[model samples]
Target chain A: MPVFDQGYRRFEGTLRPRHALGALVWTAVRPRLRWWLWLLAAILSFYPGLVYAAITFITLAVGPDAFGGRNRLPEASGAFVAFSDNGDPSQLVAELLAPTTAGIVARLWRISEQCALAGFVLPAVACAGVIATDRATGAHQIYFARPVTRMRYLLSRIAAVTVFCSVATVLPPLLVWLETAALHDDPWFAAQTWSAPFAIALSGAVYAYFVSGVVLALSSTLRRPLVVGLATIFSYLFLQVVSAMIVHGLEDKRWRALDPQYALGGITAPLYGVALPDWLQTPWPWLVGLVVPTLLLAYVWSRLRAVEVAT
Target chain B: MTSTAPVVRVTALEKRFGAVRALRGLDAAFPRGAVGLLGPNGAGKSTLLKVLLGLLEPDRGDAEVLGLRVAADPMAVRRAVGYMPEVDAYVSGLTGAASVRLAGILCGLPGRAAQQRAHEILYYVGLGEARYRRVEEYSTGMRQRLRFAQALVHDPELIFLDEPTNGLDPDGRDEMLALVDDLARHHGKSIVLCSHLLHDVEAVCEHVVVLREGTVALSGSVDDVRKLERGTFHVRVSGDEARFRAAAEAAGMHFAAQDGETLVVRVPDGAGAREIFRAAHAAGCVVRRLATVEQSLEGVFLRAVEGAAEARA
Candidate 1:
């Protein structure tokens, strides 16, 4: 290691290192984390979890054979009915719910698919105008002039918006999985559905990451917050519309992966052990799904570096 | 940190912007105190400042701020110094105090210390009552004060003020200048004041560096640079102006009338009153009034700029 010279000490008191990244993240997200908005996000996010939980409870209470064709019980009687076979009912129930892990994971994936709009809404609402508004007010000059590095600034802002989106997209589903798993007294239920939480978390992480990155990249390109926000929504819609038109016009469903939501679903479906449809079996969905968001984030980093250095 | 040392040093610094060269082998040193940075548009004042602040990298050369090499450790240099931008810069949706506190925190102060410094600096800058007001709602003067407060909240040893009084009214400008003077004199902070207003610089700064065409045209003490080589005397004579001009020319001096009543004469560098007296006596004119001319910073600035222009041509 090269020895460095310790120059004149400027201050008499103890000096503390600036927690610049933490400060930046807090400052960026604090104003947007209103109670009502968080409550709305929680309600929207937990809706699918609640629905999943209700289904699990109903299945547990009524018996898995209630909906199955194997049962010969009469529909008129409201009393509890069980098989007269010489076997334990609880063990039989555990055996029934054990194989339902695939269904549970598939339901979680479907939850993500159903709330695709929430992914866009949460990140867009959190970071829609963040970079644009800062540029408009020349706040970047002051920020870059401080001791905070450009990378720290960029990462902090991305992480701040990611917090909003991850809370809505990632957390609720995991909690719901935990709660659902706890409802069953089956030990194998824990072992069978152990991967369900990971699947939920992975799918949620991917969605949150892609949406936050793309939204911030869009924010970096424009100067007006309103325009940036509108452009984000419209661009996603436009891609979706164009992709649909092309898929219909060409009569090739593989073109559906050109849409971000469909591309994201392609990635999430397999995480839940669901097979893709014939058209999405191609690598186009995975390619576009991973590359597009990475490219958007790279663009955001470059734009921020340019703005900081070139200013 | 030492009063006798230069707070900023640039050696043969060069910066280019595609086809345009913003800084060309520029060399300058700003001593610890109040120094004014004077330049015309495109004279590399902003470029030099950015380089020193570590916002822009120099294409070729070395720069040091507070004895730390900027290229090697820019963040440290930035932490040691403060910059007040010329533009209206503030984080939107934040109050004045919040803005200052954020700046302090970003500059390496602890959160509580930053809060305390923000409050104290806002009050010191006369924004005490309006500290809670949103920065967007502030008037131009209040915004300018807010900018100053943020720059000073961290209490850096050096501060770069870019057009601090840009949009201030007369009273606000005076107050700002007074604060700058106080910082330099009482607080022992080094300041590099960049402005188009020469009087403002002359009023508060002890030294100045004039830039022309991406290079230092002149740099020295303000009083030393304002000193004219030849003594310029304003002489009011009661007799024939033609004869006084002829006699002044005979004495190897130049004379011009500032107005109908006052004739100005410039004597040789060493010779002074004797030549003016001899010229007046020889011309048979009554030397009613004679006073030496005081050079203005504007005159020095113009000469440096024009001199550099001529040299370039």
Candidate 2:
């Protein structure tokens, strides 16, 4: 809240509690209500991860003994394992769980990355579509004509998209973890795995925020939401593909800046186990990735504020 | 003579869209009345409303509403004036009540205050029963009323209504017109009613301004503009047309013969039908018909726009 006191008038400087609550509720409910199809699409998008998880689970269940003695494992009961041959029970249990744990971990890592990408791209498309629909139906003029400033309106919209992206990213992995814990009775296993979903969800939300800022900036300029959404998605993909092909050929580090995806990859390499030089991992990329697009969005919003509603 | 300097004032406002000018060096003032903005299509009526609402910037000149400059202190002006856009646009999934309440809160109303005001304004606009209904389910007329409801929910001193009767039935239009009239007449709220329909303006507006090609063509009280081109009178008589013509000419009245039995004469300003009756009686004519021809708003609007266009050419 910011105060503005003129000579004769005393204008209230703080946002009302109801407005903040309404913004949050609107952010949560509007995505599900306005574009349930997109929500469904988001859920369907995790099918690849689900398939990978299932394969890993089956491979782990039928131990390395299924691939011959190159991997020796015992048939295990709920509490412990008893080897049929002369074998150490603790050693057999370790061998049995190692491949399964490693596979699940690898799959989780890949799934988390995919989740981050989907979370960013899906909500960006949905929010742009929603705003475009409002403009097409003349609803934007009515909404903007109210006492609310353009900044408040855009903030509420972005908040809603972020909530949607976070929910989409976190829910699937949690469900999978819950199912695994229910079947395997591995308390340690569940505890070790829970942190991945939380981390993925947090990072995914940040990514979604950045993507939404860019998409909304484009959305304000373009008349058609679908065209804007597709162009943004395809353009990012095209840049990534082209950058991958040409980066190997480039000698200069500046060429990396041409590809946002590569730049983001380099930025997030620390979290993903791909180490960068200690000097390069200074939080600058995180700030740049998030703040630059946000400023661009603010510029777009000011332009929209100046637009006259066509009656 | 000096109350507060009118809620809104504009001096020599001008706006251009590419090569075609929308608002050409126009000056107007809105005091405390339900002022009607009468014009034809492309008359720059919409442009004027947008500029006054602080949504659009003018190419030249300045405007002040409630002592706040529109360009520099738009938020203050916006807080003081409620606007009902020509089109009906509401948050799609929101109920009528919620939408109005949201608008109230955005205007800085506290929770309980916003809710109470929303209820009162919804009832005032005659949508009390349908307050819980989603806006998508509302009819064109209901939505129009809802738009009006949102504008009034904040309890602003001034309101800008652009085509408030658009997409309304005859009865609905009448209801809206009456509501607008009551706001100005009884409550003392100033309003700028922008509409192409003259009848709508004539029903409630005390002051009228006609715009053509972004310039003021005719303005002042509705009576003053209507009186600019006075209506004529047709008197039918069972007497010689030549005699009636001679008498009319002698009296320095402009008269024309229509068919063989009627003499149409221009009714001078301030002269009534009784004068025509007396003239017929003096002429020894059995007056069978005496009809005072009145001009329609459409006719007045066309004549004004055409007059301005011709002058510009």
For the second chain, the TM-scores of the candidates in order are: 0.83, 0.80
How far residue A301's Cα lies from its native spot in candidate 1, in Å, is: 2.7
Report lDDT per candidate: 0.78, 0.65
lDDT of 2 by residue, A1-311 (tens): 00101111112344332344465347234634546655555565465446534533554565445535534332322112111223344433443355454434433434443454565566656666555656666666665565446666677667766665655555555555555555554667767666555545555565556666767677767779778778667766776566556656764434443455434544444443434544335555555567667796787677566543452
Once fitted onto the true fold, the runs of candidate 2 whose alpha carbons sit more than 4 angstroms away are A1-112, A168-202, A221-263, A270-274, A277-311, B1-5, B229-292, B295-300
Positional deviation of A266 in candidate 2, in angstroms? 2.8
lDDT of 1 by residue, B1-313 (tens): 5657799999999999998888989899999899999988889999988998888988999999999999999888888888999988888888899999999889888888888877778878888888898888999889888888878877888999999999998888888998888889877899999998999999999999999889998899998888752477778888887898899898888653355688667787788988888888899988999987778787668656666667769
DockQ (C-alpha based) per candidate is 0.29, 0.18
List model 1 lDDT by residue over A1-311, tens digit each.
01001111233445466658888887788667678877778776666556555545656666566546324322321111111123233322342355366656665666666566667776676677778878888889879988888878888877877777777667766765676677766657768887887887788777877776678888999777677767776777887899989988998878988887778888888888877777888888777777788888899999998888755
Candidate 2 TM-score to native: 0.69
Candidate 1 wrongly placed segments (more than 4 Å): A1-12, A17-19, A39-50, A53-99, A187-195, B1-3, B229-268, B271-293, B311-313
Candidate 1 TM-score versus the reference:
0.83
Worst 10 residues of 1 chain B by lDDT: B254-263
* Residue B270 miss distance in model 2 (angstroms): 8.2
